[model samples]
Each structure stands twice: as C-alpha cells, then as structure tokens.
Target: MATPTRPGNYREQAKTYDLTRGASPTIVRAVAEHLGEPRGRTLLDIAGGTGNYAQVFATRGFRVTVVDAQLAMLEHSARKLGGGHAVAGAAAHLPFSDGSFDCATLVHAVHLLQDPSPALREAHRVLREGPLVAVDPTRENAPLFVHEYFGLHPPDDARPSAEDIALLLRRAGFATVEHHPFVYTDTADGSLHALHTNALHLAGPAYLRNTSFWYGLDEEARRAGLDALARDLRSGRLEERVRAHYLEAAVRGHETVFAAWP
Candidate 1:
C-alpha cells in the first residue's frame, strides 16, 4: 500500500493545528451527543489528530485510544490534553486485536487519507459492537463563505462525497448504516485582532493543519489569496460574518457537519 505525502502535512503543521480550530464547546458537545452512549465504552479515534475528540471522550467516561500517523500530533495532543494517550499508526492497519473497541471515529481527515476504504475495514475488525461515526465535509450540501473569497475548493483526488462514503461503509461490511447532519455555529463578540488572525489561519498553516487543499495550492497562489483576503478584511469589504465562516469550513454561512455510522 502506498502512503501519500505532502510537503507541509500534519507533521509540520501540528503546532498551529489547534491554535485556530473552528470547534467550539457547542460543536464538540454536538459531536459527543452524536457518539451515542459514551459511558463505559472503549473508543478508537482513527487519525485522531491532537486528541481533540479523544479529550472529549475521555471526560465523558469512554476509555479512548487516539491513533495517528504523526508522532508530533500525538505528542502535541498529550501536552495540550495533559497526558500521553495516543498511538502512532495508519488507519489502514490499526494495531489491535479483533473487536478491540466499542466504537470508532473517523473525522474530517479521512478525505485526505491514502486509503480510506481499508481504514474503514480495519475499523470493522476492531469494533466489538457499536456505531462507527465517520464525519466528512458538509461543503457540497451548504453554501460556503470561504469560497467567495479564496475559491478554496478541495482539489479532485481521493476525497469522497457523502454518497460515496455511504457506499464505502456498506462495502466495508458495516451494518445498519446511517447518516446524520450536524451544524456547528460559533459567534465572535467584537474581537477585531482575533478575527483578523483567524482569517489568515483558515487558509492553511505553512498556508494548514487539515483540509489539505490549501496545502496543495502553490505558495504564490496562497500568498496572493491571503493578501487579498487581508485587504478586504481591513477595508471593511469583508464583514465579521464572513470571518466567522472562514473560521469553520470556509462556508461563511454554515459549516457542514456530516456524520455516517452503522
């Protein structure tokens, strides 16, 4: 199997990954609730960068295991969450016994994966009996604010659409497959400097943490786009609502929170 590589992948962008994360308490809570019952169940957070979801699970009484390909991400997650509670591995081949976890989570990062299909298969092997919640970008289903400014569409590659994901889940032998749409909304209460900084952070780190399309862009293109965005922001051409959308999935109006499970 071939592992994909990008110039400024998670290994390099782990530092700033969570600095401007769009997740708020509301969003996290929604995800937690979507996870079904969290009590006394073990979880496998595949490609669980920086333990954001794992941290939430741990507090909710679910014994959590965060697996990622980058040691740096797990290490940073440890520091931020105050414990070394993650493993370094690929989703295609998780290092665990059969039926090891009660549930598995493949968040937004799956689209960037080298082999998402095999990863879903691995999740099936590891889960004892519970739902595997796979979240992908809800961009296609919603209007985007980021698109208006940067035209930041994810490049054509291995990223799967919602329909494709459902097919994959069924192909992977998941039972009772279901799709749930969640919306995460965050509002900033008059913080100009913070808003400006967040605007740049949304583009990428290097131009990113996840959502590799920004990283995939040429350096010149990313720089030019950021400059124009800054100009609009400072000139009042860009409003606070626009900045809020950038902070999330680049859809200024709404962020698509698509979750699939079985």
Candidate 2:
C-alpha cells in the first residue's frame, strides 16, 4: 500500500504555502503580547514550519524548539534559528517530557492534522503552566471559492473552523480559551496578483486534477480559466478584500499579574 500522507508531506509546497499565508506579522505580535515577556521562558513551536513565529519568542531570550515532521522545512527553519534546536517530530507525538517548557505555540498548522486532539493534549502536557496557542487561516478569510474552482480543496478540506477549534482545545485540557478575528485586506489588483501567484504554484496538482476533464482542450481551457479569473479580479467581481479569523486562548489554570504572563 502507498504510504499514508502525513503532515510533513505539505513541505513539498512549503515555499508557496508560506507565501500564501505568512504575511501579517501582527498576528505573531498579538500572540507574543498574550504570552508576555519571554524572560526565563522556554517555548516549543509545534509543526512550526520555517519557524516564522518561533523566532519572535526566540529573539526575546527564550529557548525555542522548532518541531516539524518535514526534514526540508525543519532544515529551512534551522537556517533562520541559527543554532536553535530544530527537531524532526510529529505534532501528535511531541518528543518531550511533561511540563517541558514555559509555553507552546501552533500557528497556521492545526487544520492540516488528521487528528488534532492528541497534539493539543500533548501541548497541554508539555507546558509549564503557560498558554498553548493555536492558530489557522479562518474559512471566512481564505480564498475559498477561487481555490475550489481551481481544484485546490485538498488543503482546504483539512482546515477547521474557530468553533470546532475551541472545543478541541478545551477537551485537551486548556482551561480557558478565547477566539478572535484577524482581518486581512487586499485591493482588487493586489488580490489578483496574489491569486495568480497562488494559482501558478498550485498549477501542477490542479492541472492534473482539473484539466483531466478537459483533456481534449486542456491547454486551451487552462488558459481561458486563468484569463477569466484575471478579468474577474480586475473587474472587481472577485471580491478582493479578504478577512480571516484567528483564535488566541490563554489556558486558565495559570494566573499571572494581568492576562499577559511571562
């Protein structure tokens, strides 16, 4: 039998995935604000591909671990971390002991899991009385229909909503949690450019999945779809302004002066 696809398989398209979702550094700052000062804190960033947000805490003097199942992505993140530990591990089974760190974070990678409950539970067990942050691209904020039209639903189908996410974290032992919406804006022109870049990156898989139906006219149809999408984007019919919701919850058990804890 074929090897089942795991979270790390996503590394095959890590570059595009990061570009598509990595903008908006504000979200990371907000998470930091919640986690508070990093003095004497240790952080475990689960499935933290390329360590985009992990660096935030690491720079603040916290010992950071960037864990992912993908060697390629872990390698990429290691270059940025510069001697910081980058471990090749699965989120569902983090290679750590209980209360191993001051805090933990899972950014933009939750929805990709086949089972998130185990990972959340692991995060809870590994934290030393601090928050376990989980974040993802909200459905409302994603380029839903456009991506679907292009047969890019494999990843989309993996994403979960805010409500479901909160429930999962609570079950995993997070005492208290809060959900917030993060808004992303893009003008029609800008949105179109972003979409084109995305489509091009997804073209290989999308062509095989979608163009199969238009085999006799695959090339022509593909070009036409691109043209039509561009026209729609330029004509303001594509709904360029995108808004995505993110969740930031502080697990209740730990109490610090002010909601922000070190």
Candidate 3:
C-alpha cells in the first residue's frame, strides 16, 4: 500500500508534543488581535495541533472548531482546552459547509501541506467572505544556531516566504492580502541538559515532530546536526538565542485575518 499523504508526524509525537512545543502567548495574542473582536465570531482552526492557538480566540467567546488529520492531536486539544468542535479531515478537503465560518485560522500548518493550492482554496471556500490568516517562520529570520546546526542556508527555499504566502492567498481569490513581519526571540533556560531537551523539542521526529525540518535532511546530516547541537550546548559555544522570524497575514480588509503556520 502507498504511504498516506499527511501533514506532520503527529501519531508518534502526540504523547510529548505539547511538552516539545511551547505556549507562545505573544503569538497567540497577535493572531487573535489581528482578527479583531471575538465576542460571537466563529473560527475554523485547520490542522490546529492541540488547539493552543484556538484557545486564545475561544476564551474570548469565539466559537472555535478544530480539524486535524491526527486523532491523537484532536484528543489532546480536547483534554487541554475542553470545549471546541473537533473534526478529523485534511486541509485540502475540509468537512465543512461552504461559507460556514466567520473567519479561519491555520496556525503554522500550511507549510506542512504537500500541495498548498488545494488547502488554500478549501480555506477560502469555508469562510464567509472573511480572512484566512496563517503564520510561519521565514527562512531569513530563523535562528542561526539551529539553522547552522542543520547546515541550512540563509535563502533556503524549503520553507515558504511571506511573499509566497501572499501570492498563495491571492491565487486563492483573496482580494486584499497584507504581510506583517514579526520577530519572536527567546532563549533556553536551565543547564546544558535542559538546553538539549529544548533543542530536541524543536527538531527531530521522535521528539517534537512539529515541523518537517529534521525530516528533510539525510540520516547522516540529521545525526551530525543533532550531535553538534548537543556539543555546542554542552560546551557553551552556542548563544542559545531563538530568533524566530514570523510572518502574519491580515487579509480581506478589517474583517478576517490569517492565523499561523509552523
């Protein structure tokens, strides 16, 4: 049988996924603020991975519906956040009525797609003429320590750019698309061992599996990259600054907004 087309390696990572990833209050607030008031609005969080992003809007009285291909992730979201409609579906084929939502969000989930067009179209189709906000890290602003360990370049085309995101939105028939560039910088806490743990959360399939970054490398490269990260952490050669470059979209005027991508 052929391997199924999926977004991320959540099935294996579900047990420790939340521990690997973080709770970025700044990111959550920014995404929610861009969408304006949420008193009675409805949102579709596509591939929402545990509903961390959805909770921000949901707490403010927005009716949030989360959909992901991973049942483990949906169960996790339910366990943590407690009250959102959870669905099992692919982003390319959302099991939603046309114009069913006031707006939609994709919290760093877009780049995980094997093809972006179909998901973008589906997002556009589900919203009631509102914005479909997305967020993700730009190659330029990625943390140097992590990127260098992985042997990635400054202009790596592996990840989508803000411009590419806007073009994708435009291609999906969004009339007005705006890119908002933001920077999220932080550092690891605790000893070298803690740094190693934190780094593992961001990379490697067995750990976080949040992104396909580690999966893109060869076995040799992957092992070497991770080893180097550990060595640098232990020896105190690394600065430990996580300079995450982020792009947030404000689409379709003052109504809807793009959420995020990983």
lDDT tens digits, residue span 4-24, model 3: 556446776566666646545
Q: Any runs in candidate 3 off by more than 4 Å, and if so which? A: 1-7, 81-84, 139-145, 150-155, 185-211, 216-222, 240-262
Off by over 4 Å in 2: 1-3, 14-23, 138-143, 151-159, 185-225, 234-236, 239-262
Better of 2 and 3 by TM-score: 3
Residue 203 displacement in candidate 1 (angstroms): 7.5
Worst 10 residues of 3 by lDDT: 247-256
> Which ten contiguous residues of candidate 2 have the minimum total lDDT?
245-254
* Number of colliding residue pairs in model 3: 14
Taking all chains together, each candidate's TM-score versus the true structure is: 0.77, 0.69, 0.77
Per-residue lDDT of candidate 2, residues 1-262 (tens digit): 9855553345454544444434334455547766877787888889887676677678778789999988777876788787658898988889988888888878656656778899888888888767776656443333334443444444644445666777788888888787665432221111221233233322333322221122323465557655666665566554432111011111111101111112
lDDT score for residue 64 of model 2: 91
Ranking of all candidate structures by their lDDT, best first: 3, 1, 2
Q: Residues 42-145, candidate 1: write the lDDT tens digits.
A: 98888888787677777788888888888888886576456546888888889888998888777666656656789888888898876787666543433444
